[model samples]
Target: MTKPVRKRARETSGGQGRSRPEEPGEGGEEEAVTFIAEQVGALRKLAERHKLDVLHYLLGMTKLEADEHLRLRSKRKLS
Candidate 1:
C-alpha cells in the first residue's frame, strides 16, 4: 500500500491566520514608509537610467503611494 500524506502544522492549525496590515497612523509606520519611498525612488531612477521603462513606471507608481502615505501621516500629526 502507498504511504499516506500528512498535513503540515499550519494546515492543521485552525487558529493560525495572517496578521492585519498596519494602518497609516500607527506607530513605526512613518519611518518604514519613508525608508520604502527612499529605496523605491532610488530603484526607479536606476531603472530610468537603464531605459527599463516598464519597471521604472511601476516603481514610480509605488513611490507615489509611499509619498502619499507620508503626506497623510504628516497631515494627521498636524491635526
Candidate 2:
C-alpha cells in the first residue's frame, strides 16, 4: 500500500524567500538603461582608439593591406 503525499503551504509574506515587486516610477529601469548606454559609449570609444592603433601598426607593415582594412572598416561603419 502507498501513502498519499501532502502539499506544502506557500508563504504569503514575511517569509525567508519573499521578494517585493518593483513599483512604477522607481527609476531603477531608467538608471540601468543610462548605465548601459554609458558603458556602450565608452566601449565604442575604446574600440575606435584600438582600431586606429591597429591601422597605424598595419600601415607601417603594409600600406596596401592597411588601406584595405580601412576600406572594410568604413564600409562596416556605413552599414
Candidate 3:
C-alpha cells in the first residue's frame, strides 16, 4: 500500500496576488459570450442531426431536464 502524501501551500506575494486592470475596447466579455453562444448552437444542431440525446447520455440527465436547462439559459440571455 502507498503512503498518503502531504500537500504544500502555494506562495503568494505580500499576502495578496497582483491583479491587472482591464483595458478599454478589449472586447473580452463580449467575445467570450459570443463564442460560447456559437458553440452551443453548433452542438445543438449536431445533436439534432445525429439523432443523439447527448445531454442524456453524457450528463445523465433526462430529456425534459436538459430541455428545461436550455430554455432557462436562452430566457436569461434575452433579458
Candidate 4:
C-alpha cells in the first residue's frame, strides 16, 4: 500500500498562519463566480456528449456535497 503524505508546518505572523500571496489582477470575486459557472456549463455539455452517468449523479447532489465529493475524487486521482 502507498503511504500517506504529510503536510509541512506552516509559517505564521502575529500568532496566525500567514497566507500565500494573491495572484496579480485576479479579477474581483464575481469573476471567479462567472468562471466557475462557465466551466460547469461546459462540463454539463461534455457529460451529455459522453453519457457520463456518474457526472449526472454528482451534478444532482446538493451544491456543498457535490463540491466536497468532487474535491475528494480529484485529490485521489492526482495521487
- Per-candidate TM-scores read 0.66, 0.33, 0.38, 0.45
Q: Which ranking of candidates, highest TM-score first?
A: 1, 4, 3, 2
Instruction: Rank candidates by lDDT, best first.
Output: 1, 4, 3, 2
Comparing 2 with 3 on lDDT, the higher-scoring candidate is 3
Tens-place lDDT per residue, model 4, 9-77, is 866545555444458977744455455655666777677688997885565343345455556766987
Q: Give the TM-score of candidate 1.
A: 0.66
TM-score of 4: 0.45
How many residue-pair clashes does candidate 1 contain? 0
> Against the true structure, candidate 2 has what lDDT?
0.57
User: What's the distance in Å from true for residue 35, model 4?
Assistant: 0.3
> Which pairs of residues clash in candidate 1, taking residues 3 or more apart in a chain or in different chains?
none
In model 4, the clashing pairs are none
Local accuracy of candidate 1 as per-residue lDDT tens digits, 4-69: 999876444234464456677765767888999999999999999999999999999999999999
Model 1 global lDDT (CA atoms, 0 to 1): 0.88
**For model 3, how does the per-residue alpha-carbon lDDT over 29-61 read when each residue is reduced to its tens digit?**
445455555566566667766778864254333
Worst 10 residues of 4 by lDDT: 59-68
Off by over 4 Å in 4: 1-9, 12-21, 60-79
Maximum-TM-score candidate: 1
